[model samples]
Target: MTEQEYFTVHHQLTINAEPLPEGSSLPSYPIFESEIPAPFIVASEFSHLDMLNDSARKELNNSDFKHVINLLDTQNSKLNLLLTFLLSQQDDPTYRTITSAFGASQCTFLSPTSLNDGQYVRIKLFLEHPAAAIYCYASVVECQAQEQGFDITVKYQLLRDADQDLLIKAALNQQQKLLRQRSLDRENNQ
Candidate 1:
């Protein structure tokens, strides 16, 4: 998709953005299943429901199965809460940063320090509403200075298809909520 077509939303999500160790290189292509990192394996397991929900949507679009989809989504949120509890022990506070905007392809966050262009970083993102976690690698695409801090945008690299799908779903869901809120506000003002 063109960059403009790639949907992004202004949402605050906690992310751990740690620069990869010196000399580290990120793969240009998706990581092989066998070579996937342990953290990402756990993340993929938690994100399994996103795939199930997507499949149900495709199969039952506008059908009575909307209830089924809603039920599945509710279950997914509960599972994510459990996942959050399980992973909380492993979470490191030092690397945490809040994303200013994010989508399937890229994430932008404010950082006290600027990252070099083309730098590689390992990211662990936490979705608050859905309570899901994502682990991936990213390449620094841009770092622009803001009044308070630098705004760093990182392009996702070597992301598993499932994780990317989850991100896309999250972005669309957030957009829907924003639109609904705006509509409600307009109605109330009239």
Candidate 2:
């Protein structure tokens, strides 16, 4: 299949490889999706978000209401952490940020560790904005050694429909955030 079949975006990933045969053909395994939602928002956090929104709405009659709402929105925005992540080094110890390219069908990224082509591995992804985490198994399609590390391409296997949807949604959200950043940067530069 063509690479363009699904949209791609740059992101950071936490990866773990399951051992396989010394040398093998394309490996296959089931994907393990994280039960936790992204942006680390849990059921308990909904009240916090709702409270912020409620506070902002109650002040609609104030003279500076618009600006006040904007301020609250900035702090409570779902994408706030993601924007910060996109601009700075994230503190998560699980996975390091690499120049990652991901789509619905496959993902390619760079890493310090070398994984053989056809090797199966567990991948953990923290997607931007609503910051959902997805865990899945993939087979290495290609692994080229670079001066710095390994540039690896992988095709996903045994992913559930929901997990596939999550990947696609994350890619779309990330692309939107990247575009937003680019536009804002352009505006400031102008």
Candidate 3:
């Protein structure tokens, strides 16, 4: 038999060296054995993944992140958005103006007076350029109402890919910049 085949059939046994006491009220135990299963051995040969560093693998597991920027509405020649999040900070509303293959356009407004958690809002977005006037609608997915304004997440129903790309890029860019500034401020304070 091959070494691997012999190893597969071999069961390592361990036994207690000490003898039981005379007249002890105990049954004698012989041995303990273990056989490594084929599947387990094969699994052990695979490399473990570091999830933190695996952005592509992580993205695959997060399909919801891909759909987070769905389209909300479309009208006239313009487009509107139903973003996945409401503007969270006073300085960071989750909308943007972009220049794309479609030309200069803007995601111009969100609705609902307040952004408290569980409070829903219908957003109105406008696309102004190339001939003027476009509209879209969105429903709030998540939100927090504060003293100044509402932080919200809006989901778009029918916005186009190009427009959605613009919104996502804009939002992510703003968030990254904000995070960087905060980190800088912390370092400066320290």
Candidate 4:
């Protein structure tokens, strides 16, 4: 197994991990995928938001338009919140499993059943903060039995480049949030 090159965050997020049925074939990679999945559509919208932010930064290089950039930033935040609310309403609790830890390369979650090592599974990860989702394929790397159930870790096999970047950014953002909270706690204790 390749060493994890990216930082991981232990966070709770909705995910659906379904094992591939016997004799079933994996879906084509997103680039050649015929039917655009809902998660892919959502990811595309998030990418558009990222592109807009990048453009705004480039165009608003002068301090004179700092307020304009701030306004755009506020609008983006509102949009993300709205998207997140809408996505949550559509999420099916039956398929929801909270991820114990995740990074760009892989995610681990608790499951009721034992999944065989090297088993292929389809994954749909719903990210709340970024208001995005990822539809991809992964292979089960490890499954360890726990008191309640099994902790299954799957490595991404067919994730899009953009979706991977989103995961990386989300992990970094989560790390920053944790650091900030720790600093505040230390300051209060001192």
- The numbered model that scores best in TM-score is 4
Please identify model 1 stretches exceeding 4 Å from their true place. 1-5, 21-23, 27-43, 50-78
Q: Candidate 2: where are CA atoms >4 Å away?
A: 1-4, 17-19, 23-99
Give the Å error, residue 145, model 2: 1.7
Q: How far is 156's C-alpha from truth in model 2 (Å)?
A: 0.4
- Residue pairs with colliding backbones in model 1 are none
> Which 10 consecutive residues of model 4 have the lowest summed lDDT?
30-39
* Per-residue accuracy of model 2 over 38-154 as CA lDDT, tens digit each: 333331243335446675577674655787777766776755555435423323444454546887788887867787777875555555434444455678888988898888888
Per residue, candidate 4 scores C-alpha lDDT tens digits across 1-190 of: 2445676799987888878864556676645354436645775577567767787688786658888888888987887776776656656566668799999999999888898888888787887656687777888899999998999999988777777877887888788999999999999999
Q: Which candidate wins on lDDT? A: 4
* Candidate 1 lDDT, 17-102, residue by residue in tens: 88876578975454534454465567566667556667767787667677877777698777777777765654668887899999
RMSD per candidate (Å) reads 4.2, 7.3, 28.6, 3.1
* lDDT of every predicted structure (CA atoms): 0.76, 0.59, 0.29, 0.78
Error of 2 at 82 (Å): 16
* TM-score of structure candidate 1: 0.76
Off by over 4 Å in 3: 1-135, 140-153
**Which residue pairs does candidate 2 place in steric collision?**
38-131, 38-132, 39-131
State the lDDT of candidate 3 residue by residue for 62-171, as single tens digits: 67654332321122112212111111111113332221111112221222344333322222222211111212233335555656444344444333343343333334
Better of 3 and 4 by lDDT: 4
The best-first sequence of candidates by TM-score reads: 4, 1, 2, 3
- Kindly indicate the candidate among 1 and 2 with the higher TM-score: 1
